[model samples]
Target: MDPWQAGLARELIMRLPAGADSAAAGSVLQPEQLDGWSDLDLHVDLPRSAEPVDLLAGLEIWSVTEEASADRQVLRAVITDGRRVDLVITGGGRVRLPDRAPDNHIRALVAQAAAKLGRGDRLIGLHLTLELVRHCLVQAMLLRDRDQGTTIHRSGSARDALADEIAGLDLDDLGVTPRPNVVERTVDLYARWRSELEPDYRPDWSGLRAVIDRGLAGR
Candidate 1:
């Protein structure tokens, strides 16, 4: 962890309100790999009486908003100190996944990449695109395994397979367009792999293309 992150994490822990079992998560617990841009994640086990929004808002850091999640209340905000914070609040029950985590990751990356493209930041957008492709490949492998009656998480072999498949593709050819040919190809790839697990499933990339186009127009 960066020295500053360690100090800030300690301060955040001390600032936790009473009557709830709260602990630092994410990079806060892994000092060696913590980076400057890493957000501070806090997982809180709270009772019904405690209002999570009020508690986080009381910190006077920034305005907090609740995101729509089918599972539990998710409070998000960026503190004045430039550290993003995500507080996952629960009432003792675990929140089950509405969909696979890899799909959610791709959606988030698409949004972030669109924003970066809007700002005319090609480097970050490309980087995010690369991550999206990698995750898609991993998701494909996971689904493939599930079909064979062997549930397996992402492993090195899966990643290697993805690397081999895309070894000849020119990732740099992707430009700052909402509906880049590469992105369309990626969506097709995702659909092909996902169909192995979900015969009738298809991803909605039109909305993502619109978001990217909007970003480019803003640029």
Candidate 2:
């Protein structure tokens, strides 16, 4: 955890109205604490009568409109405290409130990779690297299908692009490579994602592609 980033997150949390509940923060880097170079993730439990947008009007964060989920109105603003904060406003009933939360499956995988890297476990690290990339690619594919209003299916171009991106990473220098069964493993995961969250709403693939491309480009 960066001390400066942690302080900035705390400052923004304190600025919220007194009644907000289930407000908490997390980071993509550590996944262990609300600390990282990437933007801070903040969730605020909203009251039924509250207007989420209006409440966030004064924040200086960029609005990540494309990434907003149906159940939450999300806004990203760069706070005066010198950190970008992602504020997710959701109804109280939809919020998950917990203390000492366990690492999500994805984060757990990332943490395991980091641990392996620390101990010079090259093979294990490579496996976890593929796991992480596969997870993200599957999520992107699912999101694409949901936006397209179609049954879950694979997009060869999109998957190939993702594979290219993964291959281009400096993982070899870090002592990792794609495992022998990487593709099959990815296929299995994709099938599971399709079964679990079949698209319920029509998605605009063209628009979704633009968003996905921008995200991949780190825009």
Candidate 3:
């Protein structure tokens, strides 16, 4: 981590209210490998009621967006220095996702995302696309396990696999996934690997494409 970023983190840790527990996650935990592009990921647990947003006061905040709930708050902020911070504050009511089989999960997620695009929900559509790149694609690659001449089981792996999964796609900050058909191209790449990994199962690629078409066409 940059010394300045580290100092900012320490400042955050120090400013937490009494009885609250906080720790660094993601790249912050690995100080030695920290780079200019890395962001600060902080998870905080609050025992008593407190304003979590108060933590960023007086900082060079460029933009901030948050999700608030009875039990949790998620803050995603960008510093004036261009680094991003993901801060999750939650209590005993923390949520968790159920375990899912890899192939089935990917299929479901892709279909849902494409359908979301068709419904003019571009933000969610892009979010799901990146999610697939960061996670589902990695899962599909490792599950294959044959080409490597070694068994693969974990989520982390070579960078080349990830690059291959996201090839030929222009990821945008806003939710406009058009030109060269980003959704179709990404799905095509995934379906190729998925076919080899689970030949018995089939995903509804065309159906979702129709949804995207209708949504983009404003029907």
Candidate 4:
């Protein structure tokens, strides 16, 4: 339910040549429920009388690859706006929610990232660390939302929840100021996000912090 993707999907359906019955999407993004690391799983149906070529004609696309399928027509595309989309055209269906990375999978990768840093493999370690922060966490958040009945979707939508968690903090809250250092702040943020998941299934926050602290000890 990402507003952007949802709007785009609607625009997509409306623009289709008449007789297009419905559009659908799923997985990853439920903006109200979970707008996190997910993709635009958009699908629409072309009327039996309409040709894909006709539907594609005059539509702006940056690049696309035709996917061969025995049942439906598929096109993997990067639209003009740089949004990657999968155009799945079939008979018709209603537009649905738009799209999990598992917790253990990310935990394992983060562990590798930590180990890499500990071993002086700075480049790979940094790569993993940054990717986890920027991308993987959102996926994990989305999964958590699904598990928790869609109460929290992503970091963007959880401002209220975050505020509640730190309601009466000092003016120089770590979320705002560099309380101790970036590493400690990172640990704190992870601790907050980790709470949304089942304790047993959550990542080892303390373990992660220890690795990072050790990894960055010398420089």
Candidate 5:
């Protein structure tokens, strides 16, 4: 029997609206064995009439706070008990990975980095920088035809396993010393991978690239 806690999952499921359906995902779903650190990974599917924001509002009983909301496809949050909840909500359709999910995910981060940088917030910039690097690593793995779902669902060990296979990249411990350059380096790294993986793939990184370069010059 898995020792991991399912109380959170059960409670979350109970709170979901009548039309909503959910199942185990992430580490919790990979193996039946569970532990103290095993949180919940609930993939929720809502009927066409249901909305993620509405569902989130209902979660107020648990003092849930939204971490990020992107349409009805993704909803992440933290509960009052300090456990993180990642809900990938779909509109009655199954959640499927796109062929170029890495490409799409990276571009979104670049845009976010630009917005946060404009606000002159080092803290948010640092966070985005870290996320960018991580996504790039994952993207590279996807390009090589590895199991994208499992790799992302098991991020900690997945990163380690991929890192061992890819040589000479120094992905470990990209400290936030030169904050501006961190973003630049991450984008540059992604571009290199993108070029190798999909030669025809193109994204408008000029604007963000300019900003990152300008920041590096002043530093």
Candidate 6:
């Protein structure tokens, strides 16, 4: 990690409420350790009484990683208190944990990716690429759920209705106007590997790539 980036992450971690555990920071990618990308990932255990939104007030957000399935919401805040920091808050289910719950597909994927990452294999590059794609796809699904006013716990008819509403929304408004074929290709890849990897690993890449493409293109 870059010295400046590590300093920033440490500074942000220090600023969090006392008693915050698991206060560690890492680069977004393994190769980033060589290229110096400097994207920081921080995990903190927040108190139940703590309001993340209130803590994030006035902080300029670089991005928000939303995982409805895990009820994990993270705010990548930049230019806050003169430092850039990524604040990840887990909503009850503790998305950062490496265990699988019945309804938490997003967490399962992340945990699997992290496990692969820890293996230090020669195919780390390929694992990293797949993990990046999976992360983007899951984030897209969570954003879709949020836009449709559905929570991770919602299911049955309510979940189906929300999914339809999300599918019906104008892709352009979400900043995703890319070709459907490309989205489908990524989704198909995700589907093929999802079952082989984890039982809860269901990533709708078609919907996800659209959102990711929009976010990147918009940037």
Which candidate wins on TM-score?
Answer: 1
TM for every model, in the order presented, reads 0.44, 0.32, 0.41, 0.35, 0.35, 0.32
Model 4 Cα lDDT, one tens digit per residue, 1-219: 234557666766666666665555664254544222223566666545522434444444434555455456676543343344567777632222111123434443454554554454567756665655544355455545665676645444443454443332332321211323323433355545665544554444443443344334421
lDDT of 5: 0.52
Candidate 3 C-alpha lDDT tens digits along 100-215:
23454554555556555545578888888878776646546566555565675565456356565476466553343553356666767666666666777555454345435444
Q: Which candidate achieves the best lDDT against the true structure?
A: 3
List model 1 lDDT by residue over 143-187, tens digit each.
Answer: 657755576545444445555656545566666543454555565
Q: Count backbone overlaps in model 1.
A: 1
**At residue 33, what lDDT does model 4 achieve?**
42
- Report the alpha-carbon TM-score of model 2 versus the true structure: 0.32
Residue 188, candidate 5: C-alpha displacement in angstroms: 1.1
Model 2 ranges off by over 4 Å: 1-103, 152-160, 175-219
- C-alpha lDDT values of all predictions: 0.55, 0.46, 0.59, 0.47, 0.52, 0.41
Q: Write the per-residue lDDT of candidate 6 for residues 68-166, one digit (tens) a residue.
A: 434555644333122334556653423222222342443333322222322333254245445545554554555446556665545443334434433
Q: Is candidate 1 or candidate 4 better by TM-score?
A: 1
Model 2, position 153: C-alpha lDDT score: 55
The pairs that clash in candidate 3 are: none
Ranking by lDDT: 3, 1, 5, 4, 2, 6
RMSD of 2: 12.4
| Cα RMSD to the true fold for all candidates | 12.0, 12.4, 15.6, 17.8, 16.1, 13.8
Considering summed lDDT, which 10 consecutive residues are worst modelled in model 2?
Answer: 94-103
Q: Weakest 10 consecutive residues, lDDT, candidate 5?
A: 60-69
Q: Candidate 1's C-alpha lDDT? A: 0.55
